[model samples]
Target: MTMEHGRAAGTTRKPKVVFVLGATATGKSKLAVAIAKRFDGEVVNADKIQVHAGAPVITNKVTEEDMAGVPHHLLGVLPADAEFTAEDFRRKAGRAVARVLAAGRLPVVAGGSNTYIEELVDRDNAAFRERYDALFVWTDAEPEVLDWYVALRVDDMVARGLVNEARAVFVPDDADYTRGVRRAIGLPEMHGYLLAEREGGAGEEELLALLARAVGEIKENTCRLARAQAGKIRRLSGLEGWDVRRVDVTPVFACMKDGGAACHQETWRKLVWEPCQEMVRSFLEAPGCRPCSSIRPARR
Candidate 1:
């Protein structure tokens, strides 16, 4: 189904959807914003954790200033305590794409939440099969380098008051970490530290040790999550037969280590931004291009 743009006999022409998918801390948000600005599109977050309200530091959500006036949907729209299932996301995100299409703008869905993204993009439905044109641009980086990057991000989140953010929603006796935003990597790891902070106000040295251990655990767990996410992206690639254009941002991270933030930005523009923009432009204009799902193409 890589031809006829996914059209079928008696099938309605569906809207085009661009996807920016990758592991955590690989700069998917930045690239999504860049693609939106270039193609006059809006960003629809597919990250399940990011859809919850608050815990922005923990989730590493795109800040308002970073969005640069580009509209974003399904981002922090749900309550932090609310349960948002994959089916919930499928319904809402479908509406979001429709709204974007109604305004005659492209839809760029971006997030590391591959399961949620898969639910929305690969669901078996007659109208959905006939109605979507998907182009995925996956941003990836080497594990060692990206693990370092995610560690740095954990430190940055701490500096941004992640402990206090978790404290706001921390429950003392609750062992169930599988619900809502509490499932975020940082919060679950910090459970021990949060307990110490709440119960033992006098154990100065022990509390500090607990806090440090919690932060370290957060970094380690976050790196694990990133690896798992990368693996899931690979799984989706094989299972769904997607036409994925991968952009490696390892060089950008390396530049940051050698030069600094400025150098990293310059390297990113060259390695990640420019190529994605060109790819997006071609995707938007290419004829006979189609969403590479398993759906059989209609006979002409």
Candidate 2:
């Protein structure tokens, strides 16, 4: 068996990994980029779907423009049809983190996938696992606001050729979701509409109505996924192994909607970035050890 060590003995300190985790549309990727920019960090994806090559539309990939010149790894690298397990993420993310640190950069694991993040952080190789100074940052929003964001995002996906994206990977009604991209949230939700449209039995009006209904279902399903993610984070935050901090982004979004990008950035810096910045700064200041959680999640 081959074992990889994260750091050499007598090295100044083991590398630290900053994980920005949350449900879809919670600005996890944006905040990760902010931290990476401030701390000279690179992003290693923990979202299973985004790791797959192609399907950027379906997986909601962070655009290169939005990345603000920071490097991102483990994104769109795997084949779209490939089966990626948590263990797979562990191996790839570990190497990504090591390489980032080797180049004198911090590693930011940013994504909405709780399982992949947990596996990479805690369940990976035992030798290197102990050496990692890991910090978990969770982004959250109000339930209604999350629902609205998800619904709007689904609408945007439709505008961005979501139907075509679904058609490329739609499966049979009885198809098992475990295979290929069938497991993706939007694909399964839009499968019926794609199939009906391809079959050419439904009239134009009926097809349009079906498409509308499918989009609605996708929004509803996405909200459910968000709730499930919250439950996962709740359990994860209670664990004693890793330092966890949760940031509620509802106010930021509201400011953005009412004000603009400038206002959003300011609010983000105040609420999200500064706290994470303090954590990263403290971790770098006290190298070779995990930073204690200084900010706790808001009490519900």
Candidate 3:
């Protein structure tokens, strides 16, 4: 049956799902629990870390006492060393959502892992998927070697494309011997430079030295770009209708830590509990918000 947004047949409206996301040390769990209590919702774990088992103390898994009888799914269910991927989370989380709907309860996903949340929402479009894969390849390469290789490839590709006719023809010399043969056969110039640096031959040491300097320059440039982007984000965040706020919950967590619980209760309070509670409360108290008829108490 098609579900209408909090409306009976012939009533016009659509219900919206609620999502709460933030960085670590934000109180997501507490907020989710509180929201669940108020709205008769079931909380779903969206953070990747909270899925591991056997280390609630280390991972700050929610305790029964902390849950206060509210239902939380997908927490402390996996072994710590076991690998869990986004695809795994997506399948499991989708099932959890379906179950919540089947039970006529609100499904609230709360967590700090932005990537996990994005996957839960199925926002992985082709462009993002391609970019994600590219990033994985990029990060796996040695920084200095990768930078030099990338630079050379980009330059060569641009030259081949005839985007710039004035560019010098890339030649593989004895100094560029590392992967010069590969580069000569149409490998990216960047890869060739890296290969030469790594292989180190007669005068390859000089080439390697040049590559090191180039890498340093690249790092500095990258940092500058990041800072500039951050500044832009800050500026844009201050624009109209932006409700961005950064809260420091360190003191609250510190208190929980100093209070001397068996583990990092402060992390739980800050990362899970508080943030979840706030999000729940905000949605519940929003103007025109009403009790969702879809919400039903889960059978114990």
Candidate 4:
């Protein structure tokens, strides 16, 4: 991989990557698309669920419309039943970043899957530091705020055909949930309800009860996932010394919950979008990394 536009004149510089990372449902993906547009960049998915094929609704994969025509890699490219690991992600993500750099575009790795990020960024910190200048942006919200938003998003997903999408991938006889798209949150949560409905021997009231229970489980599990993801980011930032620039987007969420659609857009630009644009601007303008005794970030 070579650094093209990220370089200055004839000077060879390390390839630059900005990671948009944080807990689920924190608008990380949307912010990433905006960043890519501002910086002539492409997004590479690091979210494990999103790598699997199909089940977009359940896995919460960003759609083409959401991606806004920005080139995306490692997203929805794996077979639905394939088992993917952090090591697998590291190899694929490295190639994806290289391809973006070769095309003279900045590379933005965006997702909630922190292990994949860790594998790519920290597994070989010394060599990684030598080869790339990286900026880590953590888009965060208050835990309580996120708890509300996640449940709301799960409802929205269901309204947008989450149950049907999950049904399409449902396996009635087999309930392994250990690997592949079946392991996605919505699929496992919906298993009991889907199986019961498919079997067609249950009463109407019983089916409704099971379905409601399934939806509740989906919401609760997703909330738990957001918490776990946040914990991982904390570990990476604190124990591993990742220089993560955290931007609390709680205002954006709070406003969305109460404000009109028009106000929502305005609040987003002011509180989340504009600030991130400036952060990436400054990082790009900064000099590339120099070899040092340590790659650890200074304590925040």
Candidate 5:
């Protein structure tokens, strides 16, 4: 079942699975969709928040109009209050990949959830037993640019009714914020604002102050998450060695909001997608090399 170079028992090789991973607000989802379109692939959601149902604005789910009919899976399927784990994701994602392969379409797994992506990379997982190569595309942005994007996104979320979304989903007694969609970024930070609103008697200025504080906390927390994500990637890279590819996307977001969709798409195609295509192409054409531990020299 293994594919060595271009030959697999003299049969044509299958497309490699592509994993697009990065911190939140790094444009990973956008790139995933575009790559899927270019490569005739389907995007499989790996973000924990995006997996839950009915919180598109809160979770920043890719919109239907924005999807461009590329077909995305595992988005908004789980109940917001339901509990799920990395093992659960592995099982579901395996089934999804199998289905995508059965339909002869490439599977592009994309999200900001590093743990979920790492689980898929684990060889013990069923997804890794299919005898197909996987290409890990790590999307990145400059720290300052990422900060700007996260702040802007938080502001936009507030303008688009994030407060109301928090109000609707907030549970007064639910202190276990680590469970289900509650674990989503930005919710716990809004606790103070929600509490102040429910307590009443606060002036408009005071309410605004509370919201501003919450917004700041959201940005800080997101940056912290990005740092932790980077640490995990570093550890994983050390273990996986040459399997990881990093792509800087700071410029893509720099002009994304200012009517630069077409321009951004072209830039991404040239910088990220094209390089990924070349890497995977090279891998498919090169003779497969076994690990050093698995090699046994012939006896003299």
Candidate 6:
């Protein structure tokens, strides 16, 4: 079956991976299992914790029974003390994805580590630069105009009492000046700005507080968008009978805090099963080209 964004249509490539990420204690494994079962997908581990062989309990590796007939890869493959880097993960994950494609099954990567997902989706292309140019056409305008606009925005913020004028300095066309405004205004470059500031003698406490607020805002916005996107993807893909949902399962681990062999089944249901089910059902009902899972035909 073929799928297309606009005019172009071709075989629907199925490197379709769903990554589940959240903090420690999130029920990432259970969710991966449910998604795998529903979509005929396989789970690929992205958690650094679950990679260690001896610390199954400590790392919370998915058990055999929990797999529910779904295939899982990369779990318990590393020793606890061995260092694993993002580069290592990206290489291994790429291979796993290829293998999953060869086996005619979907590959689902799940974990709480954000670094894993970021690295997996990182694109080395000019698309980002093009996007930036398109969004800010006047970015290359006269330095005076750019400076005036920046100063205006900063001055407005100052009037609103959001910044301390005594510490803030405005320099025309300066990268630091632009970065500072971006941070003060709760923009995406805030993290980079904060890091730079910290290295440049910013007080730890003040920087931390600013970072906390920025992070909270980012999380709230991200969660809102994720919930909406998850729902939309489920609805659109379900009608076509192709499972395309991924979840972030972090709460499951939290429920295990007291420490015991007993599992937090409720957390699993709420954080993993429910979302997976929703997506699976939606995909099964949506209208679209089916994913190609044939082993007979090889890509040229």
- Which candidate number has the best TM-score? 4
TM-score of decoy 1: 0.89
> For each candidate, what is the lDDT?
0.81, 0.78, 0.46, 0.83, 0.74, 0.46
Q: How would you encode candidate 2's per-residue C-alpha lDDT over 1-300 as one tens digit per residue?
A: 111122335665556778898888999899899888887888998888888876678788998899999999988887777898888888888888889888877888899889887787667445445877777788888888888778878888889988898787665656566654566778777767778887899999988998888888888888999999888887888765656677788888788768888998899888777777786666656643443454565343
- Top-lDDT candidate index: 4
Can you write out model 5's per-residue Cα lDDT over 210-294, one digit (the tens) per residue? 9899889987998888878766765665554226667777767776755477987777667666765565445445534331221
What C-alpha lDDT does candidate 6 achieve relative to the native structure?
0.46
Find the 10 residues in a row with the least total lDDT in model 1: 291-300
Q: For model 5, what is the alpha-carbon lDDT of residue 28?
A: 80
Pairs clashing in candidate 2? none
lDDT of 1 by residue, 1-300 (tens): 122332335655555788998899999899899888877788999988889888888888899999999999999888877899999988999999888877778888999889888888778553443577777788888899998888888898999999999898888897468877778888888889888788867488998899899999998988888889888887776754366666778899999988998999999988788777767766766633542332222111
Tens-place lDDT digits, model 3, residues 1-300: 223213345644333345544333234566667656666778788767677654343234667998999888888787544567788887787788667756766666766555665565534453222321100000011234333433443344433442121113333453341231211212232344555544666285777665555444434443343334334324433443222233333444444436545344655455435553454344433423322332211111
Q: Give the TM-scores of the predictions, in the order they appear.
A: 0.89, 0.87, 0.44, 0.92, 0.84, 0.45
TM-score, structure 5 vs. true: 0.84
Stretches off by above 4 angstroms in model 3 are: 1-9, 12-15, 122-300
RMSD versus native structure for model 6: 17.1
True-vs-predicted CA distance for residue 240, candidate 2, Å: 1.8
Model 4 misplacement above 4 A: 1-4, 10-12, 239-241, 288-300
Q: Judge candidate 6 at residue 255 and give its lDDT.
A: 48
Collision count for each candidate, in order: 0, 0, 23, 0, 0, 20
Q: Model 5, residue 240: displacement in angstroms?
A: 3.1
